[model samples]
Target: MKTITSIQKHKGTTPLTVITAYDALFASLFDQKVDIILVGDSLNMSFNAKPDTLSASMDVMLYHTKAVCAGAKETFIVCDMPFGTYTDEKTAIYNASRVYAETDAHAVKIEGGIARAPIIKALTQNSIAVMGHIGLMPQFVRSEGGYKVRGRTEEDIVTLIEDARAVEKAGAFSVVIEGVVEEAAKRISEAISIPTIGIGAGKYTDGQVLVWSDMLGFFQAFQPKFVKRYLEGATLVQTALDAYIKEVQERSFPQTEYTYQK
Candidate 1:
């Protein structure tokens, strides 16, 4: 399990690995294998069959975070502060502290850049560990008029750099840069001392994170360009299910090595 210091120290060294898990079963399987296990709000979409992460609430996040911690006791976990839960300093502290008191999560992740720096600073000052999120935040999808890939232009790259710097200055141990152009992601990584975890951002970040279902091929609704499916989980599971149904329908499943004849 990587600690805050260890995760930060990994900035220029080995690239860190992160993946999301919403339940104990998968968290146990991923335990000790990845650098961080994020109980991301992505569960709203992948597990709860929701359209986006905005509808995920604090209760939803905390419930899953506790389950993940139970399964990955040895793994470092980060709970995402769900939408509308951290809109202000008071709200941020109240909610973030709940994560610490309710579960063994090592940190809490919040989306925003320079604009949320004050909130981030407030959380850190109160002893809450924070991982900043920047560049095409999902929580702002509706407001931003949909998911937009950032850092495509030189000006946008500069803005992203500033966002990265502000986050670091606000005392974030690490930050996630998502949905940005490759070169701009590289530049942001160069500009920040804290570790940068990339999702759709690109390969040059200090670390990479992917939703478990996306990487394992379980979520078949759609595939993002950044998600590299390592397994055809849906196909394999369906095939197995088909075989089970065939055996059951044929009454071949209970052939019985020998049922108790008492």
Candidate 2:
């Protein structure tokens, strides 16, 4: 099983591959192929059809976490601490502790920076490893208006660096630098000791991650410029469904070859 030590060891050598998986089917498919399987709250949009991750709840997140855990025994699992689950240090610890105890997840990820450092520290101190999220925090997207690349301004880049530093100092095992400028992401990766996983942050980080549905073309509700579709999943599903419907209407399905023989 890949652990914190294994993740840490990949810093300068190999680039890690991380992807999101919320249920058994997807998790099982990603099992040994990926370095990390994040039970992401992106499920709020991908699975539940919610507006954003802010609407996701702890119970919902845990339900998916358990499913992923069941499917992925060896891949490192990191469960997202959904919005509102970590409002304060006490609440954060309680929720983080819940993830640690209730599931086989190896770590919990929470989005933020200096303000979240104390919470991260508390969780790590209590023996729950944490993965910090910086750059465009979906939980706080209301303030940013919408999803836009960060680190465009000099001040923003400085703040991002500080945020990365704060989380590392707080004892986070790794950090996800999302939706930031390429150069800024690279600088932050070089500045930090822990592995930096970039989402839209560019090729400079130690590793990269993407939402499972986005990469597989299963989701197209709101396409981000960062996601690269690896397969035409939605189109394929539609074609298959269309064929089934046409065949069933034409009484062409359940052919003798497909029927069970007694």
Candidate 3:
């Protein structure tokens, strides 16, 4: 597969496919289909490490990015710039550079818009492809009050549109529109020359993305309304675990055929 930078060259002409991946197993599996694999900081919540992504750090992201990159031979890996790691231009560029150097990722994704343009420009100028993220940014969940849909009001719609434009003008190869009104997302996609990847932002986007764990049913504690679970791996895993425990308790496991004869 081509690098994300190469994929960006086809923006507006070809759809870009992406998915979140934290480990080699999933990365290898999705690499065949996805053009980009995002090592998202959502691992903090998904792994039960913390209630929000704010607790996630660059080290944590790099560890998972490395694991994903190990098996992702085809798909371009884009490591996420975790919360707190990119609050300003100086820090954003510094941390973003670190991610590229450490994980050898094809690109890095940061949440925000106009205010983040400088950092995005710096990364891109330094040869690091940057993917912009806007609309209900999870990194600002606490500040924003919670996980809520954006672009619902006239003011929000205008802000979101401007944010999208700012990122594109600032040199983001592509942008992700998440948890925004459908009409707003469609408008942004139409307005920007770069491909717009959406999650709960509607079907008019150039492409779509989802948290792999959420889609695979690995995360059962909570499910976002916009996310559709395609597989129930959680239930299957529980059933298998239960059977294993029962067999062990009843001494039915490791029979002669399953064990080596000494």
Clashing pairs in 2: none
Cα deviation of 57, candidate 1, in Å: 0.6
Give the poorly placed runs of model 1, Cα more than 4 Å off. 257-262
lDDT of 2 at 2: 82
Residue-by-residue lDDT tens digits, candidate 3, 1-262: 7755577676666667778999999898998688788899888888855888998878889899999999898788889889888777678778877887787688889999878888788778877788899998999899889999998898988888899999999888889999999999988888888888998898888888899989989898888887889999899999999999999999999788999887
The runs of at least 3 residues in candidate 3 whose Cα sits more than 4 Å from the true structure, single-residue gaps closed, are: 9-14
Q: Rank the candidate models, highest TM-score first.
A: 1, 2, 3
lDDT winner among the candidates?
Answer: 1
Q: Per-residue CA lDDT of candidate 1, range 111-188, in tens?
A: 999999999999999999999999989999999999899999999999999999999999999999999999999999
Candidate 1: TM-score?
0.98
lDDT of 2 by residue, 1-262 (tens): 7889999988867988999999988899999999999999999899888887888889988999999999988899999999889888899999988898899999999999999999999999989999999999999888789887899988989999999999999999999999999999988998899999999999989999999999999997877988989998999999999999999999999899999999
Q: Judge candidate 3 at residue 95 and give its lDDT.
A: 85
Model 2's C-alpha root-mean-square deviation from the true structure amounts to 1.0
